[model samples]
Target: MESPGRYRYRPANTLYAASHDWFSPYLSRPVRELLDAGPHARSLLRSPRNVDVCILFTDIRGFTDLSRTIGSDRLFRTVDACIGRQIRIIEHYDGYVDNFTGDGLMAVFEGPDMTDSACRCALEVVSRALPAVRYGEAALAPIGAGLHRGDVAMGTLGCESRLTHTAIGDTVNRAARLTGFARGRDVVISERIRRGLSAETAARFAPVQADRRRTDIDAIAPIYRSRCG
Candidate 1:
């Protein structure tokens, strides 16, 4: 057995370390605050709850095409750096990252201003990824984002040894489908999201014209596109 001194319980040290640990960045601010107060995994995820939140999904437009032009090593680094920047912007707007898909990410925003926060974050994400800064021999591609707001089941899954915190339901699906519809440097928002925005914010987005392409998708009609970026 290892010596007790090698890893003795130290509340202060553990709290400080936990706040800066790799896993900490993945947690929502409220969850991090809870863990900081009582550093316990059980308490952190004991109860599942339904929450009203804005979900945003972003993906690099034409990523598959971009991938073919770059080496794997450079592609990996470029994507990592790009995602890191987007995550910072998400947190800045009081949002939490849900998951990352190699060239994109899903984030959640809650609270009274969740709609505004998610909208602003999506716009910024598009703008931030617009500049093709060199990453060795490759560059990050411009991204497309989508936002929707609705109720979702938020909780942890899996056994004690390995748990994953995620949100599920039609709300999540719609947001992702909206992302698929977004064009490069565009922020596509569902009607629900557009309705939630403040007047001034809502005015910034233009209604997406209905076309055969969009009409074919389920529940994706009447979306709005923000071209601010």
Candidate 2:
């Protein structure tokens, strides 16, 4: 017969340890704040904070066809390298990476100089990251980017067990939509972003007629493109 003392139970440290491990990966200040709020997290979702931010989105041009031609191992290595370099440059210019989008990424720059910072980051991606990335015999495909500035709702959204801190609103959608109009090595910006730029920065871009007849965004707002030498 087994004695009762032989089956002594340990405290619930395992459960606590598992939870810590799960949340530890997302230890950024913003994510930590959401996790610390506990029950208040629900209220935060209902009334998300509003902030003026410059949203930047970038994607590799013709990535679909390119992926089909390249081996998966080589393809992923090239993509990872390209994205890592781009992200480093973005963070260097004080921008925050929001999320990765398959062959692309979304990021944001806030504060009074958000527009200028975002523009500089985009230019750097064109001149630096794009040129450095390569596959076997092919140079990395050109990147298409878009930038727009507007107020967006930022907060945690998801079920209690798994929450994600993200920004959402028309501004985000518009920025994403604008990226579709961008072609190889093109950096397009909304009129609002252009207005926020300093004189010299504004002079770097030229107004371009974007074919928005198929898209849902406002076609009246002029789009501008910048080229890197």
All candidates: CA RMSD (Å): 6.6, 10.0
Model 2, span 95-210: residue lDDT tens:
86787899999998877678998998997886677766776686677898989999999876778688667889999999998888788887889999999888988888899886
TM-score of each: 0.82, 0.81
Q: lDDT (0-100) at residue 222 of candidate 1? A: 83
Q: What is the lDDT of candidate 1?
A: 0.78
What is the RMSD of candidate 1? 6.6
Alpha carbon deviation, residue 61, candidate 1 (Å): 0.9
Give lDDT tens digits, candidate 1, residues 40-66. 545546667788889999999888988
Q: After superposition, how far is residue 153 of candidate 2 from its true place, in Å?
A: 0.6
After superposition, the stretches of candidate 2 with alpha carbons farther than 4 Å from their true spots are 1-29, 32-47
